[model samples]
Target: MSHYHYSADQLSQKQAYKFLTGAIAPRPIAWISTHNLETRVTNLAPFSFFTILSSRIPLVMLSVNRRPDGTPKDTARNLLAAQETKNETARTAGVIHIVTPELLSAMNQTAASLSFTDSELELLPDELQLLQEKDAPLAVENAKIRFNVRPFQHQLLTDRSDLPMTDIFYLEVTDFYFDETVFDAKREYILTEKLAPVARLAGNDYSHLGLLETLRRPD
Candidate 1:
């Protein structure tokens, strides 16, 4: 019957972040990749604040938070953002990938902070990366699951000078790419253990698939 409670308005930035991120343990991560047509360079980054907005229409959300210095990260900057278009079809597109255990090393490598002009994919060691020429710009070649996404709607969280700005993008999933090994075509369900998708914990922690049990609701 005893627990600590703090008011949101009273908490400091560090305290607020620590509580939010810590309480929301093991969140699914979105390993996003976008191409800057102008620079002819690719950008890849990971966001833990990701989830499905709608499944019937196929939409997913990825939130990109500004850095400690209050600057937008490369992915947010490159997200068909600079050249926004009115038409959804004409809008710039990118890929949202699901990280598996095998791709963990490469995924972590892409999370490094780099300049807008610099490409993060190139920073990975040869042993952890294997990108194909034709499929190179689309998505991470090593990831088992991916969503070809186009920006359906975008909103800026807030721009207060004292607080970090975050960009909220709801992407329409045009299609899904699943490696045959992890997909069950007949049943149309993924093999969770085989994929062993990675989840983000607070700070530098990550988690993989564990024991699973299905519970059914009474009809």
Candidate 2:
């Protein structure tokens, strides 16, 4: 077999991004759904750069970036709602909310650009439930798991010093909601199979979790 070596410097930023994003294969997407308490807007969007960071404390992180125009993203804007929590329950529970696989399509629709006043809440079919907690919209009727985030920090960095980007928000997850079907008790395990979760891939592609394999660690 013959192989050719290519230097990282040989690639353009866009090229490098495509190569990395596509080559990474399957990625789990946090199909986030948030409702703006003040604006009365519900935004649904997907982020492959999301994952649960810790379980003991039940922490989740969403590595959100600025909009293409270098403006703060809608999701980031919703985090500001955290600041309005006057009640102890809302303050302790956090701001942004999370939705799981069940409402993936509805969440995707929220990603669309509509009038700020348009209500995505009405778009949900009668079957889905939109629970209001401290004035936050939640896809509880369909979601298998949901999370509430407490704003921890926001960092703006100049990665290239010449770029019109580089903003990251670090949030602390405070409250969590999980359906009974997705978890097991006797074994103390999360039954992923029952959840039928979907994940994101590069370029308008996604996948569902399938199959499982157990491999013993070699000591």
lDDT of 1: 0.78
lDDT of the candidates, in the order given: 0.78, 0.63
Q: Give candidate 2 misplaced runs (Cα > 4 Å).
A: 1-14, 80-89, 92-102, 162-166
Question: Which 10 consecutive positions of candidate 1 have the poorest summed lDDT?
Answer: 129-138
- Tell me the lDDT of model 1 at 185: 98
TM-score, cand. 2 vs. native: 0.78
Candidate 1, which segments miss by more than 4 Å at Cα? Answer: 68-70, 80-83, 87-92, 128-136, 159-164
User: Candidate 2's residue-wise lDDT over 1-219, tens digit each?
Assistant: 998566888988678767777888676666555667777677666677776677776666677766667766666667655544534455332333344566667666655666657755666667776666664555445677666666566666554655546545565666666778887867867777887777766776667677878999999
C-alpha lDDT (0 to 100) for residue 134 of candidate 2: 66
lDDT of 1 at 20: 90
Which ten residues in a row are the worst by lDDT in model 2?
Answer: 91-100
Candidate 2 displacement at residue 118 in angstroms:
3.5
lDDT of 1 at 135: 29
Cα displacement (Å) at residue 78, model 2? 1.7
Across 12-114, the per-residue lDDT of candidate 1 in tens digits comes to 9899888998989889989888887778778888899999999888989889887767777777776646338555454336778898887787789888877
Cα deviation in Å at residue 37, candidate 1? 2.1
